[model samples]
Target chain A: MSKFIGLIRNEHMKTFRRLSTWIMFGIAAALLITIAAFTAYYAEDSSGDWRADTEQQMQDLQKQVENGDVEAAAVQQDLTTMQYQLDQDIAPVQSDSLASYMESVMYYCAPFLILFIAIIAGGLVSTEFGTGTIKLLLTKTPSRFSVLTSKYVSMFITTVIFFIFFIGFSFIVGGIFFGFNGFDAKSVIFDNGETVTNNLLASTMRDYGLNFVQTLIYATIAFALSTIFRNTALAIGFSIFISMFFPTISFILSRYDWSKYILFNNVDLTVYNPGNVPAVDGMTLGFSIVVMAIYFVIITVITWFSFMKRDVTA
Target chain B: MQKQPAVEIKQVTKVIRGRKIIDRVNFSIYPGEVFGFLGPNGAGKTTTIRMIVGLMGITDGDILIKGNSIKTSHGAAMKHIGAIVENPEMYKYLSGYLNLVHFARMSDGVDKERINEVIELVGLKNRINDKVKTYSLGMRQRLGIAQALLHRPDVLILDEPTNGLDPAGIREMRHYIRNLAEKEGLAVIVSSHLLSEMELMCDRIGVLQQGKMLGVQQVHEMSSEQTQMVSFQVEPLEQAAIVLRDMGSKKPEIKDKQIIIELTRDEIPAAAAKLAKEAISIYGIQAETKTLEDTFLELTGGKEIV
Candidate 1:
């Protein structure tokens, strides 16, 4: 156990000592602050009482529903959600585009975090192989399994640390621009055209939690490729390309009945969000989780086996 | 009483992609001695070193280090081995001290003082805190040695350890290698194409060729085989040539007014007396032995050692 811990520390030292890692974090923090700053500058403040505005908007949507609009059901669901928030005495968020921007960032912009995390995971093992440090590392007392596990453990620790930093910094900067209010607000979504409600903060937390799961999966793909190929550029390039473009490709393929079984289709756990309709029919959170779990296990097993058996000839 | 060998490589073979890279090779390295692995390019020297350190797998046979088999109990075997395969590749981004500290953490009982001691041993105390990237190749090589020595393993394997070192650095490395064997009682297996360095550094030298072990011989024993080269420079070369021919010398070549012949050490004085008796004034007569290079060339069938 002590040896494994030492290996982890060594792996962390090798990774964290690289200036590129710190610069990546710097870029992430800068991005969050810039987004917060942009929101503060361009987002308009509420001109009147938020409750009254929500009530009026609900009435207008009700009228549109009564007039037999083409999207009457969705409009009606929106009216019901607005009425629920109004009845709860929670003033609707008052910014033009900055309302709950933090939650939105956590929800939709997690790919940015995953992108950098993938880069890191890709470089972790690949850099060691590329730089020929694996030769030195493996000659030590630790088994190859232990060394590989330590590298993966270090990657996990780095991911969690960076995640917390990104979230914390986003909170501070996001709070400064938009006051830390509206957490008591309800998160309302239309599930299959039916209105569903949740605590705003709770649902946002769940989204961020699930988002990390996706990041783990994406980072695993990058890491597995890195270890298998021993090339950082090829691993990062292929994994990032898949992460960025797989969804579009999956969307096109989902027209086929079996597309839901594809890894790309199931990786985005967000589609299972309450009130969010999955792009493919009959897909559920439980199903996506199961599929991802299988892929995760298979990839992990292959990577571990290869690392353990490979010859450090180079 | 006989001590067990520090490293016993028993019939180890390696096959990559269905082609044999190392074929049933066997050798033993003993404590308190430096063993040199001499081979031409692509002769599986590094491959054998890799197997000894557990960096590469053994296909057919097992390598034992301090009585632990690398094939079955790698952790136990690896605990007694420290190696720098090929070039000393390190994390160039890290400072030399940190690199040692990082490697020191892998094994048991290596503390701050031990790390400092190794730093002093490798003579890197002056530059231990500098980033490895900023270090010269020789410095990196020393740092690599320090890291390998940190764990105080029983066996030290260095493949081409002096590859990038300057002549001064090479001499220093050679000194340290011999010093470690004597002072620390660590068995050192150094693989190099530099026959001269190996001759000066190794106690026993093993020649490998085409995935085969030619033989292992004590350094002096091999050099002693060629200690009978006699060359005579006579004032009258024609008379000396005739005298040497009459003495039944086998194809003595005359070059630069000297007749060179190969004879046993006991025959040198008699051959010189015979040449002088022939009325040929002997200007100079010198006896010299061939270097390890000649022996190596003879063993490897004149193939160059890369």
Candidate 2:
């Protein structure tokens, strides 16, 4: 067990010591700062009467519901949340508030997180083969299984580190752009036709957690492709292609009842959150969990087996 | 009493994509000996080395390192083996010390002291902290040796250890490899297509051609055991040939105004005395020793060794 940890530590050293990793971190931070600056630049004044703004948003949502401009259930949920905010005298968090900026930019950051993780995971195994270091790596005391598992575990650890960096950096940047006064802000959530009040931090954490799951699935795809193909470029390219296009493909295929089984359709567990809709008409959080679990297992098994049984001819 | 073989390859065969890359190859290397795998390109030397190091699968038979079968107990088997297959390709982005540390952590009980010791042994202490990309090829090769020796394995396998090195670097590597086998009592396996390099570095060499083991021979004995072609530049070449034929020399031929005949080391003096007694004036006598290159060419049917 200690040896395995040593392997993981070795992998971490290799990953973090590279200039490319720090470049990725720099790009992620730049992206967050840019988004925060843009949000601040364009943010409208929200210091007016909160009750008037809630009524205005509710009226707009009602008009959209009547005109069928959006799904009635989703708009109805939004309407209920706004009404609950008004009834509880809880003002809607300003768009420029620290918590609101973080939440708004969190979804935008998810794709970048997936992209970064995909790039990292894609090169994790294939780079060894490309550089011909796999010979030295696998010839050690640890088994091939242990080596690959350590690499994967270290990839996850990197993802977690990147996540914390993203959250932490965004918080600091968001606080700079917008005052850090929304830490105790309340958020009104509509779940199953019922309104519930939750703190901003809790809801933001929940959203970040779900987004992390999505990033993990994408990372797994990239990692599996890396093992199977032994080409870092192709693995990263295919992963990026999938992340970029799978949603549209899933949407086109969603008309078919079997489309829910597609990984992309089930990967976005955020759809189970209130005021959002699943790609398919009937995918519960439980069902998506099972589907994602199956995919996760299958991809992980294929990756491990492929890596273990491969001949390191490179 | 015989020492146990540090590494044993028993009829190992590798079939890739319906083609036999390595066919029933067998050899063994005991401790304190340098075993050289001499073969041409595409002769399955790297493939066989990869199999021994668990980089490639063995289609048939097995490899045993320190009495542990690589197929059945790879972890245990690998613990006793250190190998650099084809090239000493380290992570160029990491410093040389970190690269050694990376490999050191993969094995059991290899500490910072051992890492520093190997760095000193390889003479890389001056630039051990430099990134690998900044090191010269010779420095990288030395670092490669350093990483392989970190665990102190019984068997050290290096495929083309002198590849891409200057002459001085090659000589240094040869000395290092020989010292490892002799002083440290490690069974060293060095693979190269250069016959002269093998002759200088290896105690014994196994010639592999077309994925088959032709023969394994002691490096010193291979040249001396064979008959040599002795040429006599005589006043009368035909007369010398006839005198040599009368003396029962086999296939004495007169060519280029010289008589050439095959003679063993023991027969050379007798033939010389006979020629002197026959009144044949010998202007010059040149005895060409049979080199390992000649034997290798003969064994592989003159296939290109480079």
Candidate 3:
């Protein structure tokens, strides 16, 4: 067991010691700062007249629903949220508030997180082969299974570190742009044809958690590709390609019943949240979890088999 | 009683795509001995080393290190073996100390002091903290050896260890490898195509050719065998050749005004006496010791070592 941890420590040392890994963190931090600055700059100073703005938004959404210019269900949901804000004496979350900025900015930052995690996952195994270090690595006392598992565990630890870094860094940046006074603010969500209120921190954490799951699946795909192809660039490129295009491809294939079985279609577990629609009519959160579990198992098997059974000629 | 062999390769064969790459090669390396694998390129030297190191699978027989089969109990068997398959390819981005620490972590019971000991042993103490990319190839090779020796396995396998090293570095490596075998009682397996290097470095050498083991012989005995080419620089080369033929020298040839005959060291005085009796002036009589290169070429059917 200590040997296993040692292996992981070795992997961590290898990963975190590289300049590219820190550069990834720098880029992520810079991007979040830019996003926070943009949000702060465009935020209108409506602190004293938020009630009137809420009433106007509710009226506009009601008109859009009656005219059939927008989907009635979505517009009605928005209208209900605004009406609840007015009745309950709760102000709508503004772009200048820390809670609202964090909740929204994560949605923008999730893709970059996935991309960075994919880069790390993609290079974890393939770089050893490229650098001819795999020969030295595999000949050690540990079995191939141990070595591969340590690498995967290290990648997972790195993913979690990236997540915490993103969330923490975004919090500081967002707090700097907007005062950190919205900890107890309530977020209005539309769930099951009803306006529901949730603590802003809880709701934002839920979004971040869901995004983390998405990043993990994508990182797994990249890691599997790294093992199979043994090329970092190809693995990372193909992962990004799949992440970018699979949603659109699944959308085009949504007309068919089998489209629901596509990994991309099921990867977005957020669609199974209370109010959002599944890409296919019947994909439950449970069903998506099972599909992802199956994919995770299959990828794990392929990766282990490829790593353990092959010769280390590289 | 003889000591037990540290590593044993018994009838090991490797078939890739229905072609035999290593065929029934058999050998055993004992503790306190430096064994060399001498063969031309494409002769399964690296493949055999890879099998012993558990980097490649054996199709037929098994390799055992310290009585543990590599194919069956890989981790247990690998515990007794430390190796550098080809180049000592360390992570270039890591410092030399971290590279040692990285490999040291993979094995059992290797601690900080052991890491530092290997660093000093390889003489990389001053530059141990420098990143590998800034080091010279010779320094990288030393770092590679440091990593391989970190775990203190009973068997140390180095495939083409002197490759890409300068002459002085090669000599230093040769001396270090020999010292390791002699003082540390480690079984060392070194593979190389350089015949002269093997002659200087190895205690015993196994000649491999086309995936077949020709033979294994002691390094000293290989060159100093019974039969040697004894050349007699005589005043009359033709008369000396005639004398050698009369003396029952098989296939005596005259070249460069000398009569050259394949004779044992015991036959030199008799041949000289016979030449003097035949009134042939023996100006010079030089016995050329057969080099490992000559014997290797003869064993591998004169294939180029490359």
Candidate 4:
């Protein structure tokens, strides 16, 4: 156990000392601060009373649908959504609260989170092979398993800290601009195909948890590729492409039956969360979790086994 | 007068794809000895070193360090060895001190004082805080040596340690390596293609060719005692030739005002004395002793080293 801890400390020191690592954090902070400033500055509260104005707008839309001047299907859908919001006591306004900003990080910035984590994970082991430091590392410990496990454990800790920083930084900057009220406001979600009300904090926390899982899964895939190929470019490039485009592909393939078993179809565990839709029809939260669990085991096993058996020739 | 060997390679063999890369090679390295591994290119020197450090698998035989087999008791055996398999590849983004600190934490019982001691021993105290990427090749090599010594292992194995060193740096390394072997009682194994450097740096030498062990011999036995061409630039060369023939020297050829004969170091003086008694005027007598280079060339049939 002490040896394992030593390995983790060593890995962390090596990782955090790099200038590139600090640059990544800098980019994340800059992007979030800019987003916060833009949203705070451009926010418009022209309605004066949002509930009364939105109710009037909803009546106008309903009148248009009734006159057969617009597509009834689309207008009917919008009316239904607005009615549900009114029922849940949700106002149509630019909410700049701490919880809302945190929610934006969970929703809008998830791709960036996956990108950063994937880059780090892809380069972690491959850089050792590229620079020939694996010789020094492997010689220090007897078991290769310990060396690799320490790296993964360090990555997990780094991911958690990065998540905390993102949320905490967003909260502080957003609160400074928009104040920290309305945290107990009601948010709308779909449960069992029915629109329902939920607390904002509970919904935002749930989304954060789901985003964490998504980031971890992508990072693991990148890590596995690092071991298999020993090239950072290929690993990182392929992971980014998958994270960005696989959902699109899955959407197109959803018409077919086999899309349900594809790995990308099951990665978005947030579909099980209240407000999101699953990639494929009839993909339950339980089914997606089982598929991802199987994939996780297979990826972890292959990575560890290959790393242990292959010679460190480089 | 048998002392226990610090490292023993007993019939170690490595095979890849049913083709032999390292045949059943065997040797032992003892404490207080500087053992040189000499070989031409593609001689499996690096492969053997990798096996010793537990980076590669052994196909047929086993290696034991301090009586612990590397195959069966790897962790215990590795605790007694410190090695740099090829070039000293370190984390370039880290400073030399941080690198050492990180590596020291991997092994058991290496403290800060020990890290400082090694840094001082390798003459890297001045630049220990600089990033490794900023270091010259020689400085990197020195840092590599310092890292290998941090654990105070019983054996130190370096492959081509002097590859990028300048002449002065090589001499400094040679001096430091000899001191470590003598004063600190660490068995040192160094592989290099530089024959003259090996001659000065090593007490005993082992040569490998085509993944096979040619033999291991003492430095003196390999070079100083071997027969060499002794040439005497003398006046009346034909008469001197006759004198050398009368002295029972074989095939003493007189060419270009010189009489040359193959003579061991002990026989050179006698050959000169016989010519003096014959009243042969000898202007200059030059005896050429075999160098490790010449011996290596003769052993491998004139294949290029390195």
Candidate 5:
């Protein structure tokens, strides 16, 4: 077990040793600041205080209605009622993307950040073949499983540390500007045109926790891709493309329902919010979670086995 | 004394795609022995080494370390071994000591003292503090050997151990390796492309060609079972061989047209000095000795160097 952990620690050191990793840390910091700046500067002014705006607009509509215009009076009464419902319907929807974009930046940042991690890490596995270092590693350890386990463990711990920084930095940045008080999801709109509201804390926690887990998942997928492809640039490109496009692909696949089991479909932590499930008759966030979990396990298991069995004499 | 067979490869074969990379190889190396795996480029030396370490699987047959199958007890078998395959692919960002420290933590029964001892043993005491990137190629190789020796395993396998080293560096490495084998009684298998170096260093030599084992012979036996060598120096080497051939010198190797012979004082003086008298300027007169390279090419028919 100590041996296994050492192997893991070795890989973790590789990440730590790279200047690019620090560069990624710097990039993540910059991206978080950018998101903060973007959120503060151009975000819709009616973001969290939507109901207040509706109320204010209604008062002005009523004043104009009262100025001797009977036709306007009837319109104001209906308009005010409509405004109240519209506020109830729209504020939460607006808040969800706003929150998700924040989560998206935090949660999916691994894929974006993997643009750096994968290229650095791609050589970690393939280089053993290229350089013949795998022989040293295998001959020293007792088992290939332990050898590979150590590598994954090391990468996981490293990713966990980065996750701490990324999630912490994102929340801090989001809190200072966006005000973390409204992180709850009041309502969420499903891709299939359905709606569910009032999942506040559960949804918020899910999104927040998934921010870290998603990075791990992205890392694992990128790792497997990097191993299979043996090229860092392709791995990074594919990881970014898959992580970024999976949700959209899932959204488009909602017309087919069967495509829901795709791994990319559920990477969106916001998909687990209150209302993002497709009305594909039998699908739920649980199913998406199950699918992603399967992909994660399968990719990981295959990666472990393949690396151990590989003939790294390139 | 031979403690036991540390590693044994029996009729092992490896095929990639449609080609046989390694074919029906068989050999054994005992504890407290320095076995040299010698071959030329692409002769499957690396492939065979990898197979023994279980970095690769045998397409057929078995590889056993300390009498345990590398496939089944691979993890457990590795606890008995240490190896370096090629260029020292260590964590470049970590200091040499940190790298050793980290590798030490993985192997059982290795501690800080052991780490420091191995660092000193490899003669990297002063530079061990520097980052691996800052270390010279020779320093890196020494550090690599330090990491491999940290666990004090029963067997140490080094692939191309002396690949890139200056004379001083190679001397340092050879001293430490020989010391480990003699003083500690550690079994070692070192691969080298330089046959003369192997002849000088290894107890037994395994000649490899294109992934096949041509022969495994003791170093003394290889040298003792003399092959034909011609060793008379001739000025204007080209003119000498041509004249020797014209004189019905069957299978004669005429360098500068000066003939060298295995025959001692009697047979050599007549042919070589006679050639000298025949206008091949005999600046130096000497007998020929069989070098490992000549024996290797002769036995394997220069099949392939891997």
Candidate 6:
């Protein structure tokens, strides 16, 4: 119906023109840049500021080995062995530049777009309550379900675009700053001598593609919080707390065999492989996605019904 | 002239958080009738009005719009009802005409020409195309009326149309509301704390006090007791009392302008002639008219509505 569409358009405009939306974009940009900076620094810093003393010690050991120092030669040999092991651990490592830097950064940074955007998403519903716009809406048309749906439709559409925009922005930066040869770049060293390698383009594109579904879940959570709380500040607070802390609590719980059933335990799907020494018994990426999808749907359903029935008198 | 009610609110009681917001309020407004809900601030007028439009749920009773129960189907109940609880929110960025058109799209049984017709009916055709942000309070009020009537509702309930307006604006709103009831045969229930404004505008008023209707009476019928007021303010208000104390007049007291006398209809002219001879210049000769305010205070036992 044109009425429903008009409601959506108006709701969309409510988010698109806000200071918080732009602030979200700013946070997203800054996060991408910061994550890229951190990755770039982490990769090249061994011979640079962070590990200057280690590089100096290696040079000194090599000199001693050349000057017929037996103890120093042994230490120099150990140093070479350590370096070889480190190289083997980080096998298939790509060159560090702004482009490759950003690729690595986005894997972590894209998830945070949910946090940056959750504030506006909360405000999308809560503002009507705080500002008393619901009275205006109900006075004209009294169907509370339609009104709530219109708001969700607006945020759903906008959040999708926001997710797409960030993915697109990071990819553009990746293609421009890092060489296109990174189409095959993969494999990276992690702590504990672990190596993660894959077809860079396919996995990265898959992650980017999955972001559409992921952001929708986040948006629905934001909506449920908004409708339940009726205050933008409170809604955003709850959403942020859940997003940031849920995964952490789940990670700590993963030490127990029972922890794998926790929804947040499956958050880190990128490097996790069931065939490898998996953390939990029989937990797969498909199962986790399905579970999280159910959680999202349940929250959305509760929001819609509650919003329709609750009194907007206050 | 009498007609069937377009809106009926029966035994409605609304309690929120252990506080009774509306208590057993009952009234029915017929088509072509301008019903004024007279009350002071916090008198539960808005709550009652919101219930009529189906924006709120009644705690104890029901509202019928064109005989349709609000509880059973509010969307259909709302179809016959148009209302402004306060100033209805208009999209500030859009033109007034566009705003009406948008509301029209949501409502059933409205056409594009109806939108234009309502624009003309509210007498805002000249500036309906202007963005509402630029509209004056009066212009916006008119646009609000236009939107309320977009679906051709049978009953139009306005909480406070003249709120925050200058004298001229109040008069303009009064004229428009009365016209809507008269010309379009829309049943109108306008609530206001300003008794004088309601007196000037409303045909029949229901005085509300403490969430209860004190009584409903016509503007003329309220003052029809026909009190005779005679007043005179002398140097010593009690001094002139001694001279007129021995008269056939009963308990004549010196007030501001004339000596007070509650005279029979036949005695008014004779008393006035005697007072004139005594040089008590009759600046005015009229009954102490019972305004809606006086009626409210009189009916509420001199206590404020809230």
For model 2, residues B200-297, the per-residue Cα lDDT tens digits are 99999999988999998787663434677888888777777777885434789888888888877677778888889989887888876455678788
Instruction: For model 2, state the Cα shift of residue A301 in Å.
Output: 1.5
Backbone clash total for model 3 is 0
Candidate numbers, best TM-score first, in rank order: 4, 3, 1, 2, 5, 6
Tens digits of per-residue lDDT for model 2 on A1-314? 99999999999998899898999999988888888888888988764898987798788888887888988877766777787888889988777889887887787888889998999999999998999998899998899899999999999999999889988888899888887677988877766668877787667889899989989989989999999999999999998998899987987898999999888888888888876789888889999999999999999898899898878879
| Candidate 2: segments with Cα more than 4 A from true spot | A46-83, A189-196, B222-226, B230-263, B266-287
Docking class of 5: medium
In candidate 3, which residue pairs get closer than 3 Å at backbone N, Cα or C atoms, i.e. clash?
A: none
What does candidate 5's lDDT look like per residue over B91-186, in tens digits? Answer: 777788888877787788898899988887777888888888898888888888888888888889888888889987777777777777888888
lDDT, candidate 3, A1-314, per-residue tens: 99999999999999999999999988988888888988988988784798888887787877887888888876666777788888888877777889888877777888888899999999999999999999988888899999999999999999999989978887888888898788888878788768878787777788889988999999999999999889999989998888888877887888898988888888877786656888887778998999899989998999999999988788
TM-score (chain A only) for the predictions, listed in order: 0.90, 0.89, 0.93, 0.92, 0.70, 0.72
Among all windows of 10 consecutive residues in model 3 chain A, the one with the lowest summed lDDT is A72-81
For model 1, report DockQ: 0.78
Error at A208, model 2, angstroms = 0.4
Native interface contact recovery, model 3: 0.86
DockQ of each: 0.78, 0.80, 0.80, 0.69, 0.54, 0.32
Off by over 4 Å in 4: A67-69, A76-93, A190-193, B221-226, B232-251, B254-259, B268-287, B291-295
Per-residue error (Å), model 5, residue A29: 2.1
What C-alpha lDDT values do all the predictions have? 0.83, 0.88, 0.87, 0.85, 0.70, 0.71
**Candidate 3, position A301, lDDT:** 98
True contacts kept of 4: 0.62
**Candidate 4: Cα lDDT at A118:** 90
TM-scores, chain B, all models: 0.86, 0.84, 0.85, 0.88, 0.80, 0.84
TM-score of chain A of 6: 0.72
Clashes per prediction?
Answer: 1, 0, 0, 0, 17, 8
* Clash pairs detected, candidate 2: none
Candidate 5 chain B weakest lDDT stretch, 10 residues: B220-229
lDDT of 2 at A153: 96
